[model samples]
Target: MSDSKSKRLRDPVHGLIVFAETEPLDLLAWELIDTPEFQRLRRIRQLGVSKFTFPGATHTRFAHSVGVFDNARTLTKVISREMKRNEQIFDAPRSEVAIIAALLHDLGHGPFSHTFEGVQESRGVKKRHETWTADIIRNPNGSIRGLLERYRVGFCEEVAKLLEAEDPQDIYHAVVSSSFDADRLDYLRRDKLMTGTGAGAIDFDWLIDNVRVAEIDIGAPEDDEPVNKVSTFCLASKALPAAEQFLLARYTLHQQVYFHKATRCAEHMIGKLLRSISTVANNGKNVEKMTGLRKEHPLIRFFGKNGECVENYLALDDTVIMGSLNALTAASDKTISEVADRLCNRRLYKTLDVADVGHDDGKKRQRQRTITRDFEAEIKAGSVMIDEKASISIYSEIGGDDDRTHKKLHILDGGKPVEISRLSDIIKALEKKEQFTRFYFEKEEDREKAQRKKGQNHD
Candidate 1:
């Protein structure tokens, strides 16, 4: 938060990402990043439990957030240049909001990243990181709001709106949330480097040079075509190959790194651990004695009604969670004790693929639920044998460009705006959805596990 000096963050991905005193936006980002809430991200792993599989994947959300700021600023510069080239007046305030939004995007993530989120989701509580992010930025109780108010009245509101916007209101908005947004652009390269996987690599420089701004129509075909249209960020048709590689790289990472068996197994155990803790604590009895964790534990503040607020949400991070696991290994609850023991000892559960081509996603989920109900008692540490259905579609008309949900990435082919999928068969080939299911087992001596039971039933 120093006023007179420039700042530089040495990043492995972007190298020498700087916050210059000369640039007002850079100074703003510097102040925001200097805040304790923002620094808390340093204790939250970006790749979460993926570190178990790829020991090199220890990167934190703090660095990723900064890298995102760098990516977003670079993007705005490109758009600003385009605006100058076309004789359109640049929207400086809007660009500032984009850069700020990108910097603050992941501020609310909890311990172990998405794995902690999965814990809440399992308990029928849908607490999303994005919702927490909105709270941290605009909630009067938080210090980030005060910083924004000091900078300019109502600047915080503009950032929150863009972060939560359902549609791309402008190119600046698209820079933060579109399929080709700064977050994805930074993470793909960053994660590939951190995880030491050479497969999910994309020509980022070529993609950046090829991307340009254009007007695009929105809405899926069967849902009604072109209900709305607006000018936003899009790639030039010549950059189709680079875009294809980006999507394919993302797809490759999901299969190889994100969805690795040990990582998912560890995540499943954590989910069970959290559910048991919440169940015991919410019952309103001597929770500390029951769980063998402290009465003043960070997670204790996070599990009950207190978790809905930003203050308690910020109190938990990777170090706190992982550090507490050791004490939790001695919990009075047998399930908690065992799961913590496994996590601490690195005795990860085994996995079996439960994907079904014959059964649709809904039916497949229902089957797993029935199996979970019958077998979860013996699980000792996980929700069920089978993990939740993980579905990824590399090409979708929903996102801008042939990506996930947002406006499709548009390309001006023959001087007319066309969805990128229409012009590239490589991207079009990925339109089919890919679904994967896996069941985890603790050991042979324990009661029959998910995959073992499913196998016996089939026999």
Candidate 2:
């Protein structure tokens, strides 16, 4: 590709993303972008039902992926410059692999993004989006894998390994998957911008410039033993405020955008619809035939006994799911029709925050079981059907005891490497968990009936 032939894409979040012919990796990235599998991401919503809550959050995974690739490029250039200044050997190929891994990180996200994962998990399917991503990348028949192989013999496998964190100790590996990686950096800013939530503001340029590779001793070192020093990504002491802002941005995004009550309600409706559709489809019924769907309905494979065929998975996106929902609004099965109608018409389930719900894992489960039994008893006793939906835990375990990323992150204070928590109280506070549980009802009348029964029981 010549300089004149190089492509430049304009992005609202990242300004401009360029695929310069002068850069081999950029050209390769452009090639990957042109593939069908990568292009499918344009149809998958990045924030799932968050658009219902934040109207401007109609951004797709394709845009987010592009933003991530841009962030990776910026971070890699910074790392390369610092490595040269420090007289360290910078592996250009490894950096390229990291950049490519970042580009394809969310390739496996299904329709409605993370919301689809919740539906799959409820059905006892354990594979996450990352697992699907790895499968797609390693699939010999896939265009991404073919392109990677053509670029380098084992390049596809190398990229997959990086995505799977096979080389955790490698700094290049951290560039894509770590706590402060390009994925997080891009999503925080992009999400904030797209959702119109001006809460998450981080000086990305300062953070990128201040990032340095340092030798740090992870965890609590044993006494009288030489501390093992591993080269990992860290922020300079001068960038402590920037790092704090970044962490704050992540926390705020989760609170304001990711876990919005209305969005969760909409997501719960979708989950119920999927469950109803799956149940009907599993009974040897021709849902695709009845719905008159144009595309081969990929969801049929997901609802099948085996679960999630690659061919079917590739054909799925937000459009397919939305189209299916539109068709299902008139489904012959009442449950499927009602659920789909509610979702398509935005008549989402009403959520009631249960103050009595305990936070302890075991206690929470017991409370939930008791509430469910009572709710079902009411339903069996001829009360309106009421369903319970618990919001997924919004808290992240990033800086928790089990997490070792904090140990790897060092802040150079007075020419000495120090842990970031020691410098900022805001970052330390974010380490704690914040969780809420809510119950969902099919209708306001059902909720009233349940509450009346509960009051009568107390009397």
Candidate 3:
């Protein structure tokens, strides 16, 4: 025991977490606690549009970051004894990298978080948080990269790689990119604790304590079969419920928080607003240019050119967006502006639950057609426009073989390394499940109007 002083964090889930006698676990905390990039997390919402769906879900990324820091610290301690035994297996340097990776994993997340990225990717803009995160770390112009440089911890690329877990992804998967990662573990417990929702709760402490280090094939040399690269792994028994709970929590959060109808409506409206402004800027208009703006606020400059036209976008909390609805009750551009107003005012869009409808079913296709037409009518566009506007989840499984969870979770079963799905029935079950839900936006009034006009064969 190093007689380390008490560092208690009044966490929502675990109550007061006292890192007593912990060996300088404060390095990762200190590195992220005050950095500009980390601090910007204060400006970003965690559930994002979900706040509109669940009022209690108004937590920020700052809270999530801190929660992740705590989880990473716990994980490090859980494996500390193991790390100590195999000096070459889990060295101080690698442990430090894991901690840092956990701390800064979500640093590149911009305003409105993934919603903004979804809209951007739909427009053929190649922006990903991982890429932007890496850029910020190595960006010579940014404070974060500069701060890392100051500490001679300029391994931003490696940190980013761990955060990304690029390729043969099983070994580095748990660091930040998987269901059992620190970020997911922290958020599920933290969100459940904060929202008075037990649906996403998990025994994080148990999971952390039980984590094991196993030999993984991170391009191991031929003679290294006995032991290759040692990476974080867990037990086969823990694998089942741990993975089930993790995936189920993910599904529930998406349903209850991330894709709440109101939040989706607000995000959709915001996307429309940005699209309109971008059109104005790119169409040879003299309206202020949004060029070079951060991906979150690229429309800010275009809307007013200078001096933040939508101070609301800056002050645009969930409250601001809601308030904007009330303010826009009498505004011009009734369609676009009204949608914004309605979103802010809680006049939520109608949701069509497609969970019962399989992908290629005729009824599902009919429902999709109906919604597509309604969206077109609402925006006063044709099928082509609706086609252009439709947003799709960026399935990493472009080649079919590489699925989202295609990156396996490694578990050390009785001292032999195996893929999680191979050893755990629950993990195998998760492989067959769809962990995400898709929501299509169509105002009720627009749908009714499109329905009435359908009998007239109106193009």
Candidate 4:
């Protein structure tokens, strides 16, 4: 497999990512790698519009796919060797599926990444990345399917089963989509490494090594059947700390990096711009209007000659959106142009950190809203936004019999199985901590002016 040696990439997240040269990914995989579907990922920002906040976060799904494949390869090797030692009981077919599932886990992300989908949500569009991923795999003309055919591998079916609801008990799905799935595992590490932020740092090596396959009842609708039983790859008692570390990192990353106010502001701006364009694309205009203009369209172009609207939602990206923002910065529309200019110039909406959540928070929000309304009405400024912080905890309840606790870590202590919570106090704490943060924002000086005027009146 000299070709294996030829397919090495220097990844900023994982140092070096090596492709499988031994089997030399079949024609379908290669086709997928070359297709517009995959190539489009290169143009789609991995963090969506978050780069406006975290400049270094301009990584793409292309790199993330490669990283996931690399991680899956490593984990597969470990699991494969472990199975070989216990060959009498190990399921070889299931192991193969896990490796393949990892390789194609994110096959369906669209342009502009999640931000595009978020924008569509505002416009009554209900596309899910998972569904799109499945459609592309099932497409008869798709390259991924063709590549799998070359390997004599029913790879597309395998990916579908992993993502679809038909095979709820599938181990492949667990490895790819579960709370502790490979996607989350790799992303947590990769995102932290690339962003130079510690929020996503997880003990991936320890967690992977300690993971053990197990079945537990999670109380789904089919609880009476085997499908309700979740096949989870869990950690050992000692590795619970590692699991806690991973969860905390995920929480922190979501709060600090993923949901950072500036990042959210950029996402909001992009979302607004895309929504405006989609409204135009759906106006029954000729599809050719979006032909050469598939990438980015001037905000004015969204309006048809007759002032009708059209939507070519699929042809957008961070760069295209950014380009559009630059163009619209000088648009004739006052609010639209000002928002565009601020986004283009990095003049983000000022964020006020409101912490209290009771009546005091209610008063703060009311005052902020009043200030924002005044600013919009008087100065016509769009820079005011109020950011309130909120957090959501995911991995709580260490010993409850539910899925939250049933997805418990296991340890082979003296060859005997034991729960991880019995070993790690940190995991115990992580289980109960909040995991999400919320922010509210509005224009800056206007809020200050309103507050000053209110103070003067009170005095």
Report the number of the highest-lDDT candidate.
Answer: 1
Which residue pairs come into collision in candidate 1?
385-439, 399-407, 399-408, 400-407, 400-408, 400-409, 401-408, 401-409
* Residue 314 displacement (Å), model 1: 0.7
Which candidate number maximizes TM-score?
A: 1
**Which runs of model 1 end up more than 4 angstroms from their true locations?**
1-3, 220-226, 305-307, 355-383, 395-407, 445-459
lDDT tens readout by residue for model 2, 259-289: 7778877776777677666665565466655
Ranking by lDDT: 1, 2, 4, 3
lDDT of 1 by residue, 61-146 (tens): 99999999999999999889889977999999889889999999999788876777777887787867777888889878777998
State the displacement of the C-alpha of residue 221, model 2, in Å, after optimal TM-score superposition: 7.5
Clashes of 4: 32
Query: For model 3, how does the per-residue alpha-carbon lDDT over 350-419 read when each residue is reduced to its tens digit?
Result: 5444333555445544545554655655445411123222222212121122343423456666677677
Instruction: Tell how far residue 248 is off in model 2, in angstroms.
Output: 1.5
lDDT of 4 by residue, 361-440 (tens): 45545554555555554433324433333333444221112234344445555545455555567555655534222222
Each candidate structure's TM-score, on Cα atoms with residue i matched to residue i, is: 0.89, 0.86, 0.73, 0.76
TM-score of 4: 0.76
Question: Candidate 1 has what TM-score?
Answer: 0.89
What would you estimate as the lDDT of candidate 2? Answer: 0.73
Superior by lDDT: candidate 1 or candidate 4? 1
When summed lDDT is taken over every stretch of 10 residues in candidate 3, the lowest stretch is 391-400
- lDDT for 266 in candidate 2 is 77
Which ranking of candidates, highest TM-score first? 1, 2, 4, 3
